[model samples]
Target: MGEELKLLGAWANPFSRRVEIALKIKGVEYEYLDGDIIHNKSALLLEYNPVHKKMPVLVHNGKPIAESLMILEYIDETWKDNPILPRDPYKRAMARFWAKFLDEKCVPALWKYCWSLGEEQENAYEEACGVLKILEGELEDKKFFGGNNLGFVDITANSVGLWIVVIQEAGGFNILTPDKFPRLCKWAEEFRSCPVVKENLPPRDRLYALFKARFEKISGSKDAELASRH
Candidate 1:
């Protein structure tokens, strides 16, 4: 029997997209099941990931794996064609470190920066910029966070590359401008240009419209909250 590989994912979620990109890089074929996580969660998605019940759940030969980062590592190990992680233990650990940082630190800050208004937005912008500066330094003269190729850290940082662009444009925030983050902007350009990445990415216009409406809702609520406090 052939390998039974399946991916439970949402089309617009960056986390889900990460797994898709990794699978493409490895030339792995899998069935794509839309979780429709926002409106309605699929039974298979819940069955596979009861704990978090999130998207990008990979089921391989009856085994289910959750979390995009963990799923990416699992794909790399199982396929062993296009290696995503570093061969050296130390390097692999470092790549994990940066990936964690991007998710735990950078992504949240960027979200706040895009979702808030007035003083809160300013504070969030500063916080996000500080995180971007650290990433800029980490990138240095390298072509990618994983050095010459798109690897673990690079894949993990997909939100910074593509999602953040839509978020910024939709929310009218200049938090990740080329003037302040030249390296990151260049890196994002490079990442988006990759053949696998280019093909797998969600339509930019759809993402922009989604984020724009979401940002409007967030800002509207924040405005109401402030008005009530006065």
Candidate 2:
């Protein structure tokens, strides 16, 4: 008999979506438990990830794994039919490096740029574009970040390829225009059109609405805080 697999995730979270895509690509059957990480988290989520208390925790046969990237690796390793990482040691290392880079550098910069205002937002936007240029250079002639396949780096960059469009649309920004970064822009379109990716992605209109509401809430809170200080 197969082991019980359950994924604790939030619908709008790109990190959680990454795991969902990986599972789909691997053809792994698992139960998805949508958690309200923003408002009220479930006891299972707290129990699984007490330290970080974050979503995208994978529960397999009663054992829990936290962090989306780690969960991706775990899923890849546990179900080796459709391997996500390269077989060559050096190539595998490179893939892991790029994935970590996307998580630490690109994701944070994009998030900050979207949420912040004035000078902070400008700085973050510049930083994100600079990083994206580096990624574009890395892409060079490759179809995806992991060559032809939607491998580790491609999966990790879903935030840039998929979610960023909704974020830009909702926030009324143009950070990922064709004129500025043609290669990245093209890559984004191609990435989203992939069979696995396209099938798993959240609806653009729905994502835009969700982000719009969140952005308003954040801006309203900032306005309230500023008003209180006066």
Which regions of candidate 2 deviate over 4 angstroms?
A: 222-230
Candidates' C-alpha lDDT = 0.90, 0.89
Error of 2 at 226 (Å): 5.3
lDDT at residue 197 of model 1 (Cα atoms)? 94
TM-score of 1: 0.94
| Error in Å for residue 162 of model 2 | 1.2
lDDT of 2 at 104: 93
Model 1 over residues 1-230: C-alpha lDDT tens digits? 69999999998999999999999999998999886868787778779999998888999999999999899889989989889999999999999999999989999998787777788888777788899999999999899998999999998999999998988889876878899989999999999999999999999999999988988888789889989999
Residue by residue across 122-141, what tens digits does model 2's lDDT show? 87877888888888899998
Candidate that scores best on lDDT? 1
